[model samples]
Target: MAQTKQTRGACAFCGRQMTGNGMVKHLSACPKRKDTLGESNPKSGKEEKIYHLKIQDAWLNDFWLHLEIRSSATLKDLDSYLRSIWLECCGHLSQFSTKGHLGEEIAMDSEVSALFHPGLELTHIYDFGDSSETLIKVVGEREGTPLNEHPIYLMARNELPEVETCACGKPGAWLCMDCTESEDEVALLCEKHAKDEQHQDHNLMPIINSPRTGRCGYAGPADPPY
Candidate 1:
């Protein structure tokens, strides 16, 4: 597969930017994170078992996320979050399974604590027909006060992957579905070319930060949970 340019994203807590691998190490020892954990806010909830999860597009290494979720949260909660942030275009069926898409199906109501462990990995498949698969791994766990009222907290995520420009040597921000379907060549286009007389007849999809980009009605990600 073709590789995307190296990308960096900001830490939700301190706004410090780092590469994906670098963010993993940084999150574990970030001073701001430590400080947040140390704060004794009266509004904080009781201690709970929180699991650190690493979620990544199964095919694209460039699209990924690090999350801390309360073990009490159900698989449904995780699924809902995934939909809101990345996959919900049409209300398509989704499932969490053991091996891959054909693996043992896990119930949506199952709690995180019931299924997750230090090294457990699961596959989440959305839109069975034009599916987007994500690999979810239990990176680590800790007993601590819940970060907020939400069942999960976003720690970090990958910045958008960079794409090659159009034939005109300008940035490509649109994709021509006709070209993609034909598989003759990449359909990336700059705004100018997207509206050009020769290209305007083809169906166009905007470039977005998602593995689902140009696929089955996916427009883009919803506002992230920070």
Candidate 2:
């Protein structure tokens, strides 16, 4: 592409004298392009230039459901567009405001903070260990098969993800049965071992002295009857 000349003009913003070539690139990243670039006639019909943005994450859609929108739109416009977001979800998220943290309020008419200003960046939600900051994970599916996989979990990206603790780092709970309860879950002795007739204590009783010791039965008192 041919570069244009800077015929003595300052950047619409920041007051930098942008060269013609620099102006092209600058417009690409500029936040004010929506307002600065447009049709001339007052109220004449114009096809608004639409730009496409990627869906950053699956979970962050709590506020932005549509993956793409027009540059001419402001963050506040999106804030107003999110009415359905509040109705679908529950909890304190039932509402939103601009005064508190971005996550505290949903896009609603009630609060100023709920409004997204122009050029506001939408970060993938994350947890930052504090009174606030809840982590939002994005599990992803295998390429080409979004339906087959889960959200790509950005674990501990913003804060340590809330993970259930395992007692031995095994599949069990953080506190094993021994730690949580003083008493063990009671169960009767193996019926087959306890009922063995040949066993000394077989009479359907727990045989502490048996060689198998209530295990699979042995010769005379094989196992009691299961």
Candidate 3:
């Protein structure tokens, strides 16, 4: 079977699909947010953004952390979730990569906080040195380091429901059943669909017209066991 081209395009920051770049751009330009650097805060303001993350650890085949969290959630919060899920074998903060990428070297203390600030939906993939099934690079640059200061570009921004109506935009009601091949190809989950409890990716069966089922899609021989 041949899967169609669902990846559409690539993201500037990472190599993933344009969706990743779009998602970041949306968070960066969210109108609901006042500058976080301001001394005062908007009491009723809320920055509503969502992101996707996959646990690429080789040994932990039982864990599937396909979750959506607010942009404000901290890495510490995720650490807590891991603790709850794997009380005995959870990879502690020290064991995990600070940059979220497979082998990105970074300081997990305060610098990562500066780079991966809140209100940004980031899709991070990790490898616990098990079998290395990961293909994406979830990298973050040092706060003042060259890698952090380098400029990355994107083709387009991801869509969000809370944003203002654009003259050239359409509803992001579509689903991206990405084939998950190159690090440049990313799986996109629509924020509106998830929040409304309307249509979900998990429920979206390949209707035979989906692009992910074509030759370029690479769905392999069996569907995921969920």
Candidate 4:
């Protein structure tokens, strides 16, 4: 397999950019996050188990996210979040299942507390046709007050992967769906060639920071939860 370029993303807590594994380590000991946790006002509810999950595009390793979610949240909550941030297009059906357990579909209502544990992995499939698959791993868990009232907290994400431009070799900002269908042609294009005679009539999609980019009707990511 060919190696993809390593990309770095900013920490949601401190805005410091780091590579995937580096972000994982940084999140575990992020001082800003620790301080925020310590400074939160005590609430009436008992502390709950907050799970740390690592989600990544199954085939595109460069697109990934680290999230902190309360065990009280349901699989449906995760599904919704994933759709909003990465996969929603045409209101398609999606499902979660044990990563290697064939045909074992996890219920959407299943609570995180019931389904997750350190090292456990699940696969999320969106849209039966032109599907986008994501691998979710239970990185670890901690007992703590729920961070805000949201079901999940964005912790870290991978920066957009770098892609080569068209045959012209200029910076690419658009993808031509028509050319994409032809095995011999390059689909990526710069602003100039994207409007050139050959590609002007082609179905063009903006090159955005998403695994679903250039697939189905995905335009770009929705706004971040934070």
lDDT of each: 0.84, 0.26, 0.30, 0.83
Candidates' RMSD to native: 2.0, 24.3, 14.9, 2.4
Full candidate order by TM-score, most accurate first: 1, 4, 3, 2
Best by lDDT: 1
Residue 47's lDDT within candidate 2 is 38
Tens digit of per-residue lDDT, candidate 1, span 23-118: 777888899998988873546577878998888888887888889998889999999999888888899999999988889999999998888889
lDDT of 3 by residue, 72-165 (tens): 4455555444333322122322333432444554332322334443333332232233212222223221121111111121222222212111
Writing each residue's lDDT as its tens digit, candidate 4 over 99-211 gives 44355999999999887889999999999898888999888788888767788988888877887767798877888888775534548888998888987678998877778
Candidate 1: Cα lDDT at 179: 73
Query: Can you give the TM-score per candidate against the true fold?
Result: 0.92, 0.21, 0.27, 0.90
Native-to-model Cα distance after best TM-score fit, residue 213 in candidate 1, in Å: 0.4
Please give the lDDT score at residue 158 for candidate 2: 14
Clashing pairs in 4: none
Which ten contiguous residues of candidate 3 have the minimum total lDDT? Answer: 144-153
Evaluated at residue 76, the lDDT of candidate 3 is 50
Off by over 4 Å in 3: 1-45, 60-62, 87-93, 98-226
| Best of the candidates, TM-score | 1
The per-candidate count of clashes, in order, stands at: 0, 24, 13, 0
- List runs of model 1 lying over 4 Å from the truth: 40-44, 181-184
